[model samples]
Target: MILISLIFMNVFAITVSLLIIVADKVMSNYGSCKIIINDDKEFEVNGGTSLLRVLFERKYFIPSACGGKGTCGYCKLKVTDGGGPALPTEKLILSPREMSSGMRMACQLKVKNDLKIEIPSEYLEIQEYIGEISVSESVTSDINRIRIRLTDPKTIKYKPGQYVQIKVVTDEGTDFRAYSMASNPNRTDEIELNVKRIPDGIGSTYIHSLKVGDPIEFSGPYGDFYLQKTHRKIVCVAGGVGLAPLKSIVQYWKDNERHRRIELYYGARTIKDLYDHEFFEELARENENFLYIPGLSDPDEKWTGETGFIHQILERKMTEGENSEAYLCGPPIMIDAVMGVLDKGSISDDRIWFDKF
Candidate 1:
């Protein structure tokens, strides 16, 4: 009786597997379709694939921080026609105005037929670059500063504060993670990234395990989170490795000798986490316009300087509405706190910029 039951179960499982296979053969066969990008470029791709995957496969990489899970809301494109209805996921991330303007999340929009989508002109210029790992040194116990030298193009032109997406292959599949470039922008042959090892994070683990001379491929110069062209006093706020892009911006300013008064407020849990304070301190010493303020949330008894939250320190130090523009990069909570402080200080929202990771 037991053998008969086991046989019946096996038969049922086999039948279900066969049905799934047949369904896939019929349902997943979308044949060939045309993808018209920005009304200028066109490509033939197989239908029934996510627009994000199709674009990535064709080397037209989109900035997707959540690897096409539709969480980051970074892979948005204007679908003028033939994209079908927007998915619930897309609606969640997109504003009502954005939806009315035909913007949809590329990751959720499956290409069931010929589609017309418009991407940014800058995105069209983004290309994959091959590089070799030149340096991978630990900045802190958990954070590693990786420097890579371009091997193929030998040079990459990018604005300061832009980020690149590093590709990593794992047992599950390929994953891409974005990291801001920390190196001086004047050096076009190489780029630097500061990666904090997150527990059980596939991309960070793979990157941390890489050795010198290891090959790496990444696509980049993405994100609108860069310093605006202004002579106003620049108030830069960073927490932890959020300093990466700010470092690039500051280096660019120093390298070009841009005479802008800049005040940097860096926040960390303790003094040990303030890895690059000395670099900024030296800059402050050399340039009267550049001021470096490092604040510790939790300081030891021997430690001195600023204590408590960094946003509080910023509020105490900065004058309200002094024709200054603010740039912030940090955790969402910290960004919110800082924004509140900036608002109270009469800094308009238009003058405030932030990147929340």
Candidate 2:
């Protein structure tokens, strides 16, 4: 009698577990979903999943530097119809234009119903890569210059001046942070990123603590802030860690035999803050069309070379009608000031692009 009771109880438990699993799969599958994107392209996708993941699988990628965790706010799409309400996770980031235009957070919205959405055309080229750490070198004081090798989905084919999102975890929770690609597209297997230590920021804190062998997951090849196809001279200005994408662009131009005159302006608080200067100086020598300029904002007593702020040096040198494409990345204050000076030099607003961090 005791043996029979134990046997019956075990069977019941197994049956319950199977039933629960079946129910979960059924609830998660919402059937085939029809996506009408930009009201022009239609996609039929398996349903009951977040729009972010679905779009990527279907080849109409919307940029989400955070890999659909609902943190970075880069993966936004217009949900004209069939979007069922909104999720709490997305409320903090949606702007007024986004909230009113039938737009919804792609990561938050599941394919419960037939949907119509819109995304920028440039984002169509971005591809997610599952990359393994190839190298993690201490390039500067408290800064780690990492190289990742692409494995599954094995290549990040992107234009110069684009960025990828690296995943980060901390004692508190999981989140994602954006970092620009510092390596060129020519070097397909390995991707390079520059991570600076942030005092209390979650993502940087976690990355700073990581060692050489640690594996980190990331996605991208995102952003429209790339070099325009033009014969005009190029001026790239960067401060602190903003040099990542700009460096990629520079390397690309040099590798492709681009003969257009290019000037790079890098700013540092002191000599100690400047990184990889000798390498860039060598690049400048190899490519006669390129010039490297390093400026110090507030140098120590031992400092020399170009003093004062970066923008001041830039303003003193720039002449009108240079017919230049200006790319600036730095703190907000520096970006705004550069914009003002560029405007004064008669440079078109379209010619000026900046990355503010």
Candidate 3:
């Protein structure tokens, strides 16, 4: 009698579990959904996934640095209709003006109903490319400079200072991470990127593991941080791996002979971390119009260059000019500190463009 009772109870528990699973599958399924893009293009996607994933799967790449995590605030899209109230996660990143203008983070918004959204016309031109690692070398203790040769499209055109998103797949799932193109934009058949390894970072770890001949996938030419077309003197400040895009800009200037006065200020913690220091130094010596100032915050005994934060050197050496524009890339705190110095020098907010990673 006791054995029979135990068997009955176990059967009851298993039956209830099976029913719950069936119900969940039936309830969570939302058949199909329509996503109208820019009111010009439309796609039929399976509902219940984040807008970011749906768009990417359809080849409408949206720039997202933090995968679909809603932390990077890079995947904002204007949702015209059927996008429910903004999620609390989005509120953390969207500005009051952006929210009022219907800007929503694609990563946080789920597509349950038919949706109408707007994508920039330029975004429609972005394409995914398959490439293979041609060169991979360490630039610093934690940073690597990787070069990829495009195979499928065979070419790409991007502006200096723009970034690309590498698709990373792991047991956790698939996601994309953004890295600024360090190669000169003129190199259409290939590109270079500098990646700094983060502890347990899915994208960086995958990139670090890549070797020559390893195939990779990425989408590109995103971000408005590229150099502007103006006659103004160029002032660039970079910290550590932030040098990637700045290096691209400098190379473009050299290749195109856009001979406006340019000053580059780079900062790092130690001499070892100051990758490409010699390259910039050589360029500075050869080009009378180009100036390179590399500063070390925590220098080793062998250091003999600028000893201090880059901002301090800028304060001393930066000459205030009415027709000057500033470009900065670094940690948020470093960017904030440099912008303060630029403000004191009478550089207006419009004249200063920064990418804080």
lDDT values, one for every candidate? 0.90, 0.80, 0.91
The residue pairs in collision within model 1 are none
Q: After superposition, how far is residue 273 of candidate 3 from its true place, in Å?
A: 0.8
Best by TM-score: 1
Give the per-residue lDDT of model 3 (tens digit) for 1-357: 999999999999999999999998887687799999877889787788899989988888988999888789999999999997888999999999999899999999988889999999889889999999999999999999999999989999999899999989788877789999999998899999999999998999999999999999999889999999888889999998999999999999888746799999999998889999889989999999898999999988887778889889788889765789999999998999999899999999999988998
User: What ranges in model 3 sit over 4 Å off?
Assistant: 1-23
Task: Mark the regions of model 2 whose C-alpha exceeds 4 Å error after superposition.
Answer: 1-61, 65-73, 83-101, 107-114, 120-125, 169-174
Q: Give me the candidate number with maximum lDDT.
A: 3
Q: What is the lDDT, from 0 to 100, of the residue 349 in candidate 3? A: 97
lDDT of 1 by residue, 302-347 (tens): 7778988989999888764668899899999999999999999888
Q: Per-residue lDDT tens digits of candidate 2, residues 1-357?
A: 999999999999999999999999989888888999777889788888888878766766676665577776777788888886667777788877778777788888888879978777777655656767778778778678888888877776777888876767766665657888889878878888898888897777776776766777776777878887898888888888888888988888887737788888888888888888988989888887887888898888887667777788788776443688899887888888878877877778989877777
**Estimated TM-score for each candidate:** 0.95, 0.77, 0.94
* Cα TM-score of candidate 3: 0.94
- What number of clashing residue pairs does each candidate have, in the order they appear? 0, 0, 0
The candidate with the higher lDDT, 2 or 3, is: 3
Which regions of candidate 1 are displaced past 4 Å?
1-13
True lDDT of residue 234, candidate 1: 84
| 1 or 2, greater by lDDT | 1
Which is the better candidate, 1 or 2, if ranked by TM-score?
1
Q: What residue pairs are clashing in model 2?
A: none
